[model samples]
Target: MGSTTIGCDQRIAWLLTSARLLNPDPELARRDGFIKALADQGIKIDNSRISRWESGLHPVSGQVAATYEQALGLTEGSLVAVAAGLRRTFGNGPAPREGALRGADLTDGDMDRLLELIDEGKGTGAHWLRLVGQLGTYDRVYLRQQEWAALSARLVQELAVSVGVGFVRRYEAAAGLIRHPNAQRHLTRAIGGFVMNPDTQVVAPVLSLLTEIADEAAGDLVLRMLTSEDKNLRSAASSVAAVKVSRGHFGAHALPQLESHVVGSLRRGESLDGRLDSFDLAVQLPDESWERAMGGLRNRRAFDLVIGSRRGGELVPTQQTAAVVQRLSAAVQRDTPTHSPHENDAMLRRLLRESLLHAHKPRRHHAALLLAATPYAPAVAKHCQDLATHSNDLMAARALTVLMRVGHRMGRSRVLLQSLAETRPTIRARALVNLGLNPEPIKPAEADALLGHLDEHSRPVERHATMFALGMNGGTTLKKLAKSDTEWMARSATWWLDQGPALHDSDAALDQIGAQT
Candidate 1:
């Protein structure tokens, strides 16, 4: 590539002209006065050197350029960037079409012209791309300066257009340029101006970008957006939060708000139009559904029984509510073994057994989970084995997972090995993952056999499961999978390798699976 560097004489001439225009007093342009001014700012440049630079006899070095900027109150790096030809196109006159305006030199009219160009660029793909590039250039220079108020006003004007494609792209590009905290805060406030507006199609991207870059600082604003009465705004916020949280940023703090919004709506018997199910399930708070159910039954008889049996009170069977409470009670007891007396274990065992027989799939799944946590028994094992073979894919997967956990605890590898031979990839993947979780190591031959079952064409979800199993099992196969050209397989293997022995929670595991798909 040819060098873009300007000669020293050309750079010095531009610097002298810029310095003359920027200095408050015209006398500061003269050698003696300029030297005095540099001295005032603690710079010790000689009068002869200043005269030589203005006469184009020599170029100003970086040190002198910085000194001149400080002495004249110009934006830092503006002169040095000019001297080094870093921004060769920016001149003392109005900014060129493709160049940026120096922060100190930017004026209200200049901002207006930029906005006009952005407006004109809308709907034209190539023009919009070029404008976005120009906006990025301007942001690099002025985003950190006090010109935000003027820039923000221009942004607001652009956003007022019914279709805000140009302004949104500018917002994204500007956000990408922000490196300082103050710049981020300024941009966030600018974006926040549109949060209350009903133009979701335009506002969502801005809010999404803010949440991503601002971290917890944007949490309160996002929560408010999520709770807005406007369905569009709420949906937009939820979608933004889903992406942010799924990437492992902002999720921990924002989850309570999401759970309350979605799960709370569910508990109030309000239909979410299937929005609740569509949310990234990996981030769903564990036990959220059960907690909501328990909250609903707080005033009912079933609530009393689950909290603490209504001592001597007549236990009225409310049918459906009572059955749910029974399942929840078993789950709770299994979760808190020490709190529940030994006798309650027996009661929980019976409740889990009856729950397994219930026609409700959720009830059956919950029962299997609770059973997996309970003490081993021939009947419990039999129930798990039976459910593992059930025709329902979801229920069967849950059963097989519980069976693996129980078998691992009991040191019985037979069920796990049998599960590995299952034809369904989902089942086989789950079995492989659960088997890898067992403390006892699988023999090399068995592990190699399992690894050989996976191929480059395996479904993303299946590959995700296989990678985790291989990662946990420890083999050369994971390293090979990590090098696979398939994006999902490579990502999953890399994530598994990074996580090492630390277990992946349901959300993270689901996130890895979801991202590739």
Candidate 2:
């Protein structure tokens, strides 16, 4: 068998005519307008040269073919493919028999069969490429037929598989073809399914696709995803927005809104769980990612919007990022009833040890608090005591509060006693409140000495802390402080007196004092 070939001149004529018809601007069909379009893409060819090619006096060259595709928004390689006889024409024309597959002809069973084949072919690059190529062809054919419903269903299924296998190119191709409103609806439905029962595998790719579309609806959806509680979804959404803004797909109108959302999330201390991975992916996006970020400043006069801009430097884990602390604390409290005594002791000790050493302050504090809140264990108690004796003021304060709440006797401890007399008012106040909240009995002299120290301080914050500490002691002092001269002090003292003595020894109590003052 021999291959049939189309003449280069005829192919160029067909492509040029199709480009002219598809162009919204009728003037683009003219030689002067076409020349300007080419110049817009930085291709400066003489006017006579373009006329020569269209008049069939000269054949199109590779450079001109590429520029034509770019200027006219034609698919990459379409003109060159036609010039090389690989394709017959452009503009939703009938595909060659080998690439032809109608959406109307495919059944649900047929779609399932293709998906099964794609599944079976996973991890084989060549096989996946072939399958995706076939799918792309089917997508184009269906798109031309306006069978959006059928094509959208097929695309959604293909996207699921493509994302699972990490076939990004295939996933992009499937997404790129989803330009129709019906197809967008189907993709939205698929996204909803993932939201209800999140599968991390599809989150990144699906978000990438949605942002690539970059329409208003997609932008709004991405915004909603940014605020999602699911860490994976929010992480994916952040990455997608970064990619879109970097590539300039994020429209100028929507850019401000996206920036505001990102800033708001950062302000709220929302943890982007997979942030490192997302940043790595953004950095890896073919040299254009950096170029795009820089180009925003160089050409577009826009700010360089990138992930690094959001995360100033270093991973400063806050309360939101301390998920491990929350998880281990819950497990420790719940597992005690089920596990053996030795096992529970070892488990809690291990968790507390790991948490105490964590780089983040919040996690360390949480671990110490969890240890204090759980049933008494000697190892846990020792860990909390050691942390309380540490030099870090915040850590020491949290550890001391935990120990006091759990009924640990701190009266004779040099660290706790010195902390009460510290020059820093906040530290002194915390130590005083912790001492007052001590479940063990305090001598009248010790309680009277603490109350007398409060009379020495004129600061409202000091006065507030004194009132809380006096309230915790449960006696005539609380009644006297409730009617003190300072209005805020009196109010806090009254509230504390009304509530009576309950174990109110945590950062929350300190925060309350600050708030009252």
Candidate 3:
């Protein structure tokens, strides 16, 4: 079969006549009014053009044919046929098919009915929910706002906190409503009131309510206000608003909210000169499986947002980005029980790079901590160095603890040895005692260095931490320590080593050691 081209002038005539027939309100295409409408739409054409085609005085041109097709929102072939039929029936009066109506011709009453379905409380919430689920339905303006207010509230009131959060999040995502600042303010206030109420019992329900409002404003600037400087408001808001970024369907929305809460709290703390304590920095991932999936993504937006919050940056003043990074980094360190391998890998890589290069002290400190805890790998080596060499004694100490942890995870004695070597004598001795609890074989020189701390250092805590590290490093090290100027260090190290993983199976061994001896 071959394709046939339709003339533009004839296509325009058919389109105009067809529009008049389909328009229940006859004013839509009255006489030359349709041509004027086209002209108003930036399409240049006159009634003569239609008349000529209708009279068969001229064939329509291709450009005109395309213009008419787009202006009428009709398929090219459909418009061509309608034009041909118009030419054939001009003298016979307008074609019968010209009077036919599309669904767009629904009367005012039909529109009312559709709106009623959406606003029907318990009856319509699920309906709109299902309606929005259908592809392309979200683009319809009338359909989108039809029952939004009522449906959104009901969903918040009905579903479990997490479920409601997910559903509303999905809806707002489809509608792309998060960018509107006005909507965000109204939404934040409405939902924030519910969730921020200290008397609320069921966190899920309250969380659901806030989640509902947040959906309308998932990406709004109002998100930054959740943890604002009102001392009472921040303390009250942290509980309900505190969220974790698990990897999956909930991730796209939940992660942003989580990031907002973190930054908000951090900024509040900074404003108070670091007096504010309760920030809800803890985050619980769904499971180990999710870690791999969630951890692998860079979260560059969140990262950049926090980085800019640090002093001297390009982006908008988004609270204190460094504080936000520290809060998140602290959560990753203290809270995550597990993350998927992929997510863990990605998170570790980014954290190491960011920490090494970051100019901010608090953010760099936390980043170094996260890197220290991560398993030793080539990509992360620089972060370990940055932490060890850090000017802040506290940060360097924390980094050393993490380095040992990473070395332990990798089952690499060399990394542990080098990490201990990089530390100052006091720090090295302290670290050695920590190693004794999980002691791998240490070099004779390292053992001697740690032993010297036992008699030389007055701080019992430092001496004990070094002794523990030495015992855990295993070998004749602790027995060699038994010959120390004071036998208590050897005895303590030996006793702890005997207990091994069983010393405090219920709690963390390092924590137990720190507390006990």
Candidate 4:
């Protein structure tokens, strides 16, 4: 629990061992050789210390993580990211999910199957449509060069003039893929091509994509496009990537230009640009710049790699983090500001509100997560009443999500219950998924109705997600489903039952968890 406390994490341990064994330099791969390499980097660790890390008794982080990556010839931030990202999931704590990852975790087998699935479906248009739709939900993936070349082409081809649902699904899925290293190269090119393309249909969608995966390369590409004769292109790029002239690493060099917007929004009590957030600034700029931007926006864990370094920060949040966001809440409700006597509390509330107002749906949805992870009291409910009914449907839904999550803390479910009547599958499913968070007692009729509706849902993925919600709200239906449903669902149900009951607001558990990823 101490900041410097070392803990063994199974995933990081495996990755460390694999990196060393696979190294081509025999000396570098040997235990003694690896130690010498670290020593050369001025990391004074002996056999016992190195063994401690390799054996999973300590997690390499901060400076040590960087040294490990460099000594092993892996990319910088690689090891650090694995450590920060897993902190929330595989912490050295007593909790149900504080263990190693499971079926949801991606492996070589999963990637192999997915690549084959893409190859098999490439010939059929209907199959490509379905394939991309499904791929959108995946946070991490590996694509062969040929497959990425093919898929990236298809994405641009489809999205260049897409309207409504097709645009939303493909664009979002591609943005989600930014988390995987291999996918980012091809994905960036696809987005960059679209940015240069003059198609009006994709203007909004392109900006949305840029916002989600903004980085130094992306910042430079968009900035260069600003001088084009096309008026629409100029307008869209400027709104999202506004920055003063800069030469190298446009994002970092021009951090002040981009951060001005965030600071102005916080100071003026206005919504932040949908395309940006403080986390982006933190990753792009040096740690010393943190105080200057927004007069010092500081998170206790800002230096953790996933939340800090450009490499780790730029990737889509790891898949586990993405999956958890999907499970947060589905309800809608009214207003109440969290009356805090503390100035910092007031500052945090302002930050959360403006962030929730971001035009980017995913960023807005993250507000619920920010709240869930902060150790605030239960009084903060439906605070962003204005946003809950915003014209953007996703925005409104996300606002409702914030309230529903807050209501969970309050042991109240009015907004959550009200949302269940929603006719849209997305809406209704979200409500079902969120019901797992509400601690209020559910009537037998209500619980049965939830189970019945969950069983009847058409999509297998949706059904699987609802199973998680139901498991969290364990009752007769959970017990019944533990013995029924598909083998996976039944097994998942049984697992959830043993994971213990859902958490209460008083637990103060989510604080310091999932803020970065």
Query: In order, what lDDT does every prediction score?
Result: 0.46, 0.45, 0.38, 0.46
Residue 145, model 2, lDDT: 34
Write the residue-wise lDDT of candidate 3 on 12-95 in tens digits: 443444334333344443646657666776666677766664443455432343345445543322233233322332223333
Off by over 4 Å in 4: 1-98, 104-113, 116-144, 154-181, 204-216, 228-232, 239-352, 355-365, 368-517
> Who is ahead in lDDT, 1 or 2?
1
Candidate 3 residue 207 Cα shift, in angstroms, is: 30
Clashing pairs in 2: none
lDDT of 4 at 170: 42
Over 4 Å off, model 3: 1-350, 353-376, 408-440, 480-491, 500-517
Give the per-residue lDDT digits (tens) of candidate 4, residues 48-110.
Answer: 866766666555543454456668765333344434334432365542221221113334454
Ranked by lDDT, the better of candidates 1 and 3 is 1
TM-score of 2: 0.30
**TM-score of each candidate structure, all chains considered together:** 0.32, 0.30, 0.27, 0.32
Q: Which residue pairs clash in candidate 4?
A: 136-173, 178-316, 179-316
List, residue by residue over 1-517, the lDDT tens digit for candidate 1: 0112433354345445435533556566555777788778655667565666565545445445556655665543334433433222122332223112122333456445544554443222112223233454453444435566545544443432211122323333444433334456666776677666442223444565553463666766777877787655676677666555544455455655666665444444322222322232222234443355455432343334322211211112244245544554455444441312433434354334334333222223333433432233234555555556656554456555555434444534754565467777666666665666555555667756766677766654455555555666555566776798877667656655553432211211111110000
Higher-scoring candidate on TM-score, 3 or 4: 4
* Model 2 misplaced stretches (Cα beyond 4 Å): 1-350, 353-370, 373-379, 409-416, 441-444, 454-462, 503-517
